[model samples]
Target: MATMITDECINCGACEPECPNTAIYQGGVEYDGLDGAKHAALSNDFFYIVPEKCTECVGFFDHEACAAVCPVDCCVPDPNIPESEEVLMTRARQLHPEQAFPEDYPSRFKAGAAAPAASAAPAAAAAPAAPVAAAPAGGATFVQSPLDALADTVPALESWDVPLTCFRCRGEFEVPFQFIKPGTVLHCPHCAGSFVPNTILYRDVAKRVTKFYDSFTAGLDAIRSRHQAEIERFEDQLRQSLQKLKDDVKEASADAALAGAPQKNRGFFG
Candidate 1:
């Protein structure tokens, strides 16, 4: 019965400080332990929720604290990760050993109030997530956070899953990206192109496109240089052959002139 934040988080840092368990963190920040240490191995690309400390306000208040304060209504129950109220109550006791549930009840508590019933209502009304194959046959179907679900519906990005390539360098590659609303510019290491994720797949496509163009241009330059060198060699050989022919012609003319010297003083026929 842990509470979670959806991708709808505006990163306003509003709901972060309000968590009694300090489970909420800014996008890309690390959440280590109850002591609030950073676990560097975990990525900080987006806001994260720590499951260890979340108690769903079982003992603290009648309702979830984060859901109450969240402006975007992104704080909702995680259906994929379901837990019963008994489990939440036990966890609350572990966290605050001295606290007790219904300690101040004056015996006039409602016979069957619906706080527990309403909590399940939101999850019931929400669309069920696509079941993962690895999950147990009857296990809870893990769905993406609310933000992820919304991103999947956004159009104009259907082909984003296609590989990316760089127009300038012809470099091709795949890149990992997290969806950010209004899509932000991405930097590719291969083609060095800056692009936006129009769809979920755009980031990878852009990376691959950059890589493809880079390789293509390099290959083209190599072929051109090789052909240029061959042409220069052929031209050099032709120049050498022409020079030899000119020398031979000059020798033949000299021999002819020497051989006809005896008739030089003769008439026009000589």
Candidate 2:
């Protein structure tokens, strides 16, 4: 289980920079994974998270880093998905174990295990599914939406929770967004736009962006490789031509020398 962002996010660009795992991203941007294998497109409607890379601050902070600084208190615990403190710590260690921890740093969970269940009060399970894949190095780049007053985008999260839906295609999907701010547009993976009123259509936008991003990147690589190969071939041809010219000049010089060689006189005409 991991943390999620709700639709209340104001797109202030505050939480985007504070994320530790670089899991947070702007709605429309794409991120490359640390594995150097895949890329993920972000939604344009609201701030998003990458679940695969989110350790929920288990390894580093006693509490969540993003939640600490979010002015709106939107970075609350995700109720739907829950994990023990131990599990969160393990996840954190796995994400960034290279850092050194203080000798007396306290762990929130049981000794070498996940935190105990909180008296069986219907524990939270897992974090919402992220929209994009993890990147190779610095992960995703979050682009905060320009602030403009629009109709409130958030719902009464304290009451009924809303599900992520494709605005255009009417498809039900999973995209982790918290209700931190307003006027934050959620991006559609297929339709190439944000879902106004949060519907199924925007999923199409998201999908299309992903496809285009991948194809465009692949095409760029292909073109670059072809150009390099062509340049190399041309250089090789030029070298060969230069060598041929040199050989021809040498041959002509040799021929001239032979032709100019004075005929040997029968006797010794000095």
Least accurate stretch of 10 residues (summed lDDT) in model 1?
123-132
How far residue 252's Cα lies from its native spot in candidate 1, in Å, is: 99
- Give the number of colliding residue pairs in candidate 2: 66
In candidate 2, residue 217 scores what lDDT? 35
Local distance difference test values of all predictions, in order: 0.55, 0.54
Off by over 4 Å in 1: 34-43, 98-270
What are the per-model numbers of colliding residue pairs?
32, 66
lDDT of 1 by residue, 16-108 (tens): 666766667777666667565666423355455676677666656566666665544566677777776667666767766775557632111
Model 2, 1-270: lDDT tens digits are 566666555555666666778888887778656575557565678777766666666665555666554433345556677767567666656667796656544443426633321222221222322223233467557443221111123222222233565757876654433331244566666665675442343344444333433333333333445557788999999999999999999998876747568866788657
Q: After superposition, how far is residue 18 of candidate 1 from its true place, in Å?
A: 2.2
